[model samples]
Target: MENQWLQVSYADLLQATDGFSSANLIGVGSFGSVYKGILECFETVVAVKVLNLLQQGAFKSLAAEWEALRNIRHRNLVKILTVCSSINFNGNDFKALVFEYMPNGSLEKWLHPNVDEQPQLRNLNLTQRLNIAIDVASASSSSFENTNHDLKPGNVLLDDDMVAHVGDFGLARFLSEAAESCSQNQTSTFGIKGSIGYIPPEYGMGGKASKYGDVYSYGILLLKMITGKRPTNDMFKDNQSLHHFAKSAFPEQVMEIIDPRLLQENAEAFLDSENHNNLKNKMRDCLVALVRVGVSCSAESPGERMEMREIAMEMHAVRDLYLEVGIQ
Candidate 1:
């Protein structure tokens, strides 16, 4: 169905989200909260992203998201349904964006699930992770890079079919050529404009938003997917980073740093396959190619990073070869 923005009332949202109860709160961000709710008008479950207008820059974030998403549509990008801008019962301004609810939740929870709450780690097999990387790359290659300055695992959501959709465009900037040319040294009044570790080196140095910066964040996310480690891990201190950590183990010792869960799955396949040696070699090659792309795209220098188009093409090739191996 074609997506369209509907006029929704604050009272409607209140009922749909059960008065925004703690139970309905699915996720919280720096400027807003997301709640899972049933939208009676659409006859479907939706995510309500309520903006905290009281917070500094919150209105601007909402405006940024609206400007970024209003004209975009892509299979790999999150679908925004409608927006509500009105007064709350408390005589205060209320703003919320309704989005298609994702059943599987964010890639963050899956990558680093809490064992206390989820006894079984939600393991994303090699094939699944590869596909997700491809999906995000596809989204990155789109106009969303006009710039989605925040491309992290937490902003990637999965649907019922496990298709990855990049969302949360609060940090997005729609730039023109003239503006972009002069943006190299421009600083954001909102500070760095991205999560730590995911922010590109150039951005921290007062560079303005750019597609290259998005590519850098995508690179970090891709590496995180393969390694099952956050870029901000305690181990990545004293000048160390996720990029260096992965690059240090590239090609040869990839197996050592890769997520053990992925290795365990491959081990099971090897035990059952008569061509186990060939299978092992192919998997190694696939992983090596992935790491190389991740490392190349996340170079410290923006000029050194891979283009989003090239990254998408490489990920698609990797996923195709992986599926051909009959591992999925």
Candidate 2:
């Protein structure tokens, strides 16, 4: 494919990233390292993804990301600002892509905050979490035709205003092309392309890339965000998946498994007798609905899983109901 993106010089990127110093490093992935930089010309903060050409699939990933992001436009999707492909100061081939900076980092950090960090920074209220879940569902529903093969918490970024943006399109593929010859019931041979715990069960059985796989991954992500537990957490051993873990808790013990910070933050409001019981019941009902949705979307059978559009709609209703209860 011809490079159609606006290209920036290596020297300029080097300067913007302060010689790619450690301090500027924001994220490290299989393809490359992403650095937070400020473009002198635009005077705007941006994320610069410097490709590690030596990595196994770095070149393909770079091209895939460009192809996936170029034509797509969504509020919840990260915007690519520009591209850079040139010889660096050492004469080595360099390729980088710039994206709009997201100041709030990612969902992973918030869901599983670093113990070493301040306690206040780790808290994500019910409203914020619900909004983020809706944002992700909206993004995935819009891109269902173009399945994001790798959907995980680490790939979901948050802007300064806390709007969730689904990103990392390196493993993205169009289901229309990949599933043309296969029937809905039949599995197609697609190499495993998603993170371990987030991958759909059928994919391990040779299922092809389809919208259902994305739904499964999104389901896992929703569960993770709700419970603050990684799908691959060590506690999930002995064939106890995150789905089962959450399912077992269901409507009653969900609060026990949920992020304590969430409960702690909302505990004060439920101190009154009559109003407190009413609000608590409303909260419980909402939690039940949320977990049910998560379970339905993450069903082991692809045919049993809910569609992205349906998931998005249900999340919106849940959020609306939660808001209606007047809980902060």
Winner by TM-score? 1
What TM-score does candidate 1 reach? Answer: 0.92
lDDT per residue, candidate 2, 220-300, as tens digits?
Answer: 988887787888889988888999988899867887787777777778888844598888888877878888888888989
Residue 61, candidate 2: C-alpha displacement in angstroms: 1.0
Error of 1 at 128 (Å): 0.8
Relative to the true structure, candidate 1 has a C-alpha RMSD (angstroms) of 3.2
What lDDT does candidate 1 reach at residue 152?
90
lDDT of candidate model 2 versus the reference: 0.81
What is residue 66's positional error in candidate 2, in angstroms?
0.7
lDDT of 1 by residue, 62-141 (tens): 88887777788899888988889999999999999989999999999999987675624588999889889989998989
lDDT of each: 0.83, 0.81
How far residue 227's Cα lies from its native spot in candidate 2, in Å, is: 0.9
- Can you give the lDDT of residue 162 in candidate 2? 96
- In candidate 2, the residue pairs with backbone N, CA or C atoms under 3 Å apart (3 or more residues apart, or in different chains) clash, namely none
Each model's TM-score, in the order given? Answer: 0.92, 0.90
